[model samples]
Target: MAQQPRYAQTPTTGGAPAALAPSASSSAATTSTKIGDRAFDKIEKTSAEFFAITYGALVRQMFIDHNERADIVNTQLDQMGERIGVRLIEEYAARSGAPPCRSPAQAADSVAKIGLKMFNPQRPSQWLQPPRSSGPVSSSTGAAIGDAANGSNGGAVYSISFDENPLNVFVELPDALRQTLWYSNVLCGVIRGGLQQVGFVTLVWYVRDVLRGDDVNEIRIQFQGKERETFKVDMQK
Candidate 1:
């Protein structure tokens, strides 16, 4: 007997077979983009130049306060970003009306498409997988990069790449700070903190930074595990 096709065709009122509707993931992505655009339109505006310069000044002061200890300064920056992220995630939830992310991929999509877009507004972030062992994969910045290894013990790993970083505007790194400092390490902390707030314990770090003369800025994130909540009950005397 002859084999039949995998998907059976269904006829519509017009008598022609109906086309398949969009996939759920595709529809969800469209919805996320629309939500991000609407939220961006409603947020207060700020000058990018001003924001960059102010952040630069703050970083410089941190260098001064920490006696140019790059590691210490980096730690402090990450701490500051974590605090900001803790609050920003709440605002994002309230404004974007986005549903809770049920998986690492969904969380990554929300962060790259919605969260980052809300701040940058003009630039779009690219979610990328690392290169396979067979060959390197092309990235948004036109560089050959590989996909990150899957997180340990069934965790997930992915990268977000950016062609431009507003934080690096009007900023240059001296030779001394090149190797020791990650200028935008705060972004990694922000990702970690924001996801942590929603029950995800993630390990986030910068893999490539334009400030360090890389072709693009890439932040790698790995899902570690879910945050375990502990509550203490008091006994009345």
Candidate 2:
């Protein structure tokens, strides 16, 4: 039998229920939404069909380059995404002028509300929904980030589900590759790399894939810990 995954606990303050303060939460959401909208309007636009076709070509070439080894192609895609993400963060910071995230919850929210809007060609309203945090919700705040399954470890976990994925726009997987290839795995690496640039260490993976016959595409994100100071020094060496 497959083992179930553990999740984070709900966060709380001073014995109160785990939830964001109503007014504060609303204000923050509004501000972030506006920032996202502005950033999206300012960024350069591209033809969706062209982008999709180009990406498809890249993936197909990768398969051929790797002798049709899906696993190797997946890893290379992630690595490529990481490099892109590292550079993309610089553009994101400059263009969005958004504030830095203080918690895993905040990061998840920003990615859904801001990052996706800025980069994705789709209109903000078209996004199926914002990222969903696991665990209980407060009536006022709706569903917000909760504590980690191991609260003692001081981490959190959340998920982002999409009804539509732009990359999968013109993609159809063959039966032979369906079970082995994660068609959109680069996204997982992009998120992981982007967060790492901001000091958060995270573990990201696909929980559900639309290509795999899932109703909605979902990616799970687990906060591990902050990057150590030494990490920067080591990278410079």
Best model number under TM-score: 1
**Minimal lDDT window, size 10, model 2:** 1-10
Off by over 4 Å in 1: 1-29, 131-149, 228-237
lDDT of each: 0.67, 0.65
If scored against the real structure, what TM-score would every candidate get?
A: 0.76, 0.73
The C-alpha local distance difference test score for the whole of candidate 2 amounts to 0.65
Q: In candidate 2, which residue pairs get closer than 3 Å at backbone N, Cα or C atoms, i.e. clash?
A: 7-149, 8-147, 8-148, 8-149, 9-147, 9-148, 10-147, 11-147
lDDT of 1 by residue, 131-229 (tens): 432223357433212334565555677777888887777777866777678887788888887888887888787777777778878887788877642
Give one digit per residue, the lDDT tens place, for model 2 in 1-237: 211111223233465332111112234246777777777777876655556666777888888778888889889888887777777787677778787787787887777777776876432222222224343322233244443243324457666666667777657776677778887788888888888888888877776677777766776677889774211212221
Residue pairs that clash (backbone atoms under 3 angstroms), model 1: 129-147, 130-146, 130-147, 130-148, 131-146, 131-147
Off by over 4 Å in 2: 1-29, 122-142, 146-154, 228-237
Candidate 2, TM-score vs. the true structure?
0.73
Candidate 1 global lDDT: 0.67
